[model samples]
Target: MKVIPTACTAALLAGTAMSSVAQGVYDDALRLDPNSYETLTVTVDGEPMAVRRYEAVYVGNPVAMSATQPARSMGPGGSPASADGQELADLLTYQKMAIYVPEASIEDQSTAMIFAVNNAGWFASELRTSVETGGEYVSTSDTDKVGAALGAGYVFVDVGTRGRGIVAADGTAAGKAPAAIVDAKAAIRFLRLNDDVLPGSAERIVITGTSGGGGLSTAVAASGNASDYFPYLAEIGAAGIDADGASSLNDDVFATIAYCPITSLGYADMAYEWLYQAQRDEQLTGVSLEASQTLRSQYPSYLESLGLVLDDGTPLTADNMTDLLMQIVTQEIQDHIDEGGSVPALGEMFEFTSRGQTVEVENTWLSVVDGQIVPFEIQDFLTFVTQTSALKSVPAFDRTANSGNEGVDGENTLFGPAAQEYSNFTPFGWNMNEVAGDGSGADDTGLKWNEFVETKEGQAIAAQVKLTDPQAFLQGNADSAPYWYIRHGMIDRDTSFAVELALYRAVAGTDGVKDVNFTLPWMTPHSGNYDVQEAYGWLASVLSDAE
Candidate 1:
């Protein structure tokens, strides 16, 4: 076995302590060894395989590690964090990666790599725990993709990232918008820098993540080597930079597999109300109802402004959106039944009965006809969503100081820069209190459109918002991923069905996109990795076609 120096410094090799200044200078350059890996046994689709695991490898230059606040300020349930931030930062593993390679594929540099973006929720205080233990080293969840990749002689890389709400001891927000995606990009670049030494093909990388991580995956797929992120990358001394200070290695991937991505934050509230406005009428009263209607009214103009078209060149308008959504719902149900999967019973709104090789949906979005499920009514689908799921408030993503939603939402914190805890990204949400006296206090507490355009802080937030959105980069100069695999559960109320649909339309309509495998699975919740076989099967076909 070839042993490589863990650090380039000679003093470290001689077992001598170095000065802090020298340590900082040496830490600026990160080096990895091709042979420095541990072998582990893992089960992939019921088959045991020998896999090489590399744990907690830093993706960035940790020159000032002791000065970093690695843990988030807020805890799991909104409590104040008690973790040792210095110790976590000193580990130099916050913006890091854990790589896994199949032993059989160790010598194959052409092996496709899966960059799994670790889910860093609104506030990722739990990431410290993940790093302290070995949780981030090997993911127990998404075994289907990771296991399938290793089983197929492919490499899997777990990319850890910074999430919102991490604060410096000086009261500066360390984790904010673009930080998470930037870290993921740096990790990918690190792999590319060592393409010759690593077991995977950097050019054939595929990214996968769920929810917030899914949003990051989408951003990485869209942004690629876009110039918007160069500053952030340089700040961390990310790998793959040439002497001229330009990015020599690309961060773009071959494909993306995102599940229930909670994205398009700037316009998510409007989309949410547009889908569930009718259902909300029964649930909300007074100020909330007015605010809901106000947001709902904002959706059609925004939808039409997008210039999105169907597969057949017809404009996707509010007049025809329900029919299109119903078509998707029917198709999902039919596909599920065809695959011998039964939808769970939903009281009187939906009831399914299966006999031998046929299934029926009674008084729901679909019904069995000649041993096949067919579209019944759009109202039935809406009713299913209404009865099954509880509706969020008027302004969802950017919470207003309304009756129940008094504090800031996660995305609000995400869009804000250092020390700016909460911000309103949308004008409609910010104008609610002023327009309808809804008592949201958004005008007072949230940043309004005028300020967003006029103030420097707001302008910075605007740029960050664009950086986090995939639509801003979908057709930009940077190369978008050629193959796209996106799935959003039809029953998911986390954001809006419209958000994912917009993303699907954008990616599918792009000229460079080779193939788009998009779906809205029936009865699936706000989740991911639901169909590992199907996802991996699609990936296998794409990889084969690439060859």
Candidate 2:
């Protein structure tokens, strides 16, 4: 069994002893009354696991409209699969976050916290999933994300995922998807449904996370299908789903915070290098560029041919990719740097060589794995060049294959793709920039492409092949309920603060979220060790703004 603060352990034993044995009937008795936090233990496949206590705290007073916490996304599929509207057999891969309101205490009258909890480098089965027993669910271990939420003065719910609990055997985010995001959305809907449960949940809500989770927060802020995930949700729910998982495209969330977020899916190339270099300055430090690039060349299917496919070529230096580059293009705005420092400048930042034609695009960090080469927005050549990827020096991970991913291994991905895919696992795709009219006895690129990607029931569509390498998703309300918060601190360590700041700018700029951007004094080094004072200050300001 798992141990608590010792103070709570004795009480549990006594409670168990008092159970009633009425006429050969077993009466419910033993109950472990959790303190503000505690650690729970259980075994899966004979291995012992522990879960820490997390809570939705009330920062006491003036209301913490800006209450926030960290969330996460980790495990196998470091550089996860890529997908989007285009029919280029894009493998479906994504990392994201969720937000929810937990019952708050009397002192909890405050702005909803957009809590973020990073997924450890996979293997967060305990917090991410619960074993349902009739009407109740048994909690699992792996609660660092939950603990971070509690430390932030807000209720913490699991980001909910058990990514292929594999570390890049050598960096990749490929494999089966984690259903954790689905569980999280359920938590959010539950907190909002049936007032009797967690009735004190705040009306205002937000999301926060890093790495894959960071990417999640960004999508959550988009204001779309996220609300539909829980259609019956009174306040806390996702919108709906389109081709992509849950849509956060048009929701009304109060705020979102993403750190070193994995933003796009269609603009990927030499991926790991692009990510690490982008945040090296703000990050405590990162893997050497040489290491990142080395891993980049490994683990990907060698593209037979890939010259930029269109005029809207993606920026590869920032090194991020996504399925909806077109949608992101519409949303891309220049970064607002107080002082023009090393902040990457678009247009002049990235370049892709194809058929001797060096095509460039704003290093807006958009890319996708196209055949052999990581394709950008702009179509360059037909046969894209490609290669495998690998890790330079395997650094010490915060998460081991077993217990520490939640602690740190997961966050490592936040810095860049894992060293797994370095073994060369290439996925394929095609460009529809031009191929005649719709295929009704026609060969329109769009028509043929769409037809190619259509799947039959449970099979991979013609335009795609499941890497089956292991990846994950919240994938829009696969079910009716879920519980989630942003994920932060790649399974390795804390980073991604820049994107979180950007999320504030996006929300505050458009909606009247009254954003607050402040850092915890000793928040890094490890992802935990939250400073309540800082959170209190920020939350207080948000409340004032809302009022």
- Using TM-score as the measure, which candidate wins? 1
Candidate 1 per-residue lDDT over residues 1-547, each given as its tens digit: 0011223223233543312222222123566776787877655555566778776555454322235454445321222354554445333445767788878898898879988765534443222221121222222234355556666787888665666755544566656777777787887877776788788799988998878878888988988887566556656667754322345567888999888787888888888888887778878988778878888898999888877889999988778887777778777877778888765443334432211123333444555755576546666676666555566666787665443466555466776556556555667655543423332224554645665556765666677778888887885434899989999887667788788888888887776889899888766666677677788888889988989
Off by over 4 Å in 1: 1-28, 43-48, 55-91, 120-143, 242-245, 342-366, 372-375, 402-404, 432-448
Over the stretch 275-370, how does candidate 2's per-residue lDDT look in tens digits?
Answer: 333332233234333334443453232111121112154421222222232223222211212222132333344343322355443444323222
Assess every candidate by TM-score. 0.82, 0.37
Instruction: Go through the candidates in order and give each one's C-alpha lDDT.
Output: 0.67, 0.29
Candidate 1, run of 10 with poorest lDDT? 1-10
Candidate 2's TM-score reads 0.37
| lDDT score of residue 343 within candidate 2 | 26
The count of residue-pair clashes in candidate 1 stands at 0
TM-score of 1: 0.82
**Pairs of residues at least 3 apart in sequence or in different chains that clash in candidate 1:** none
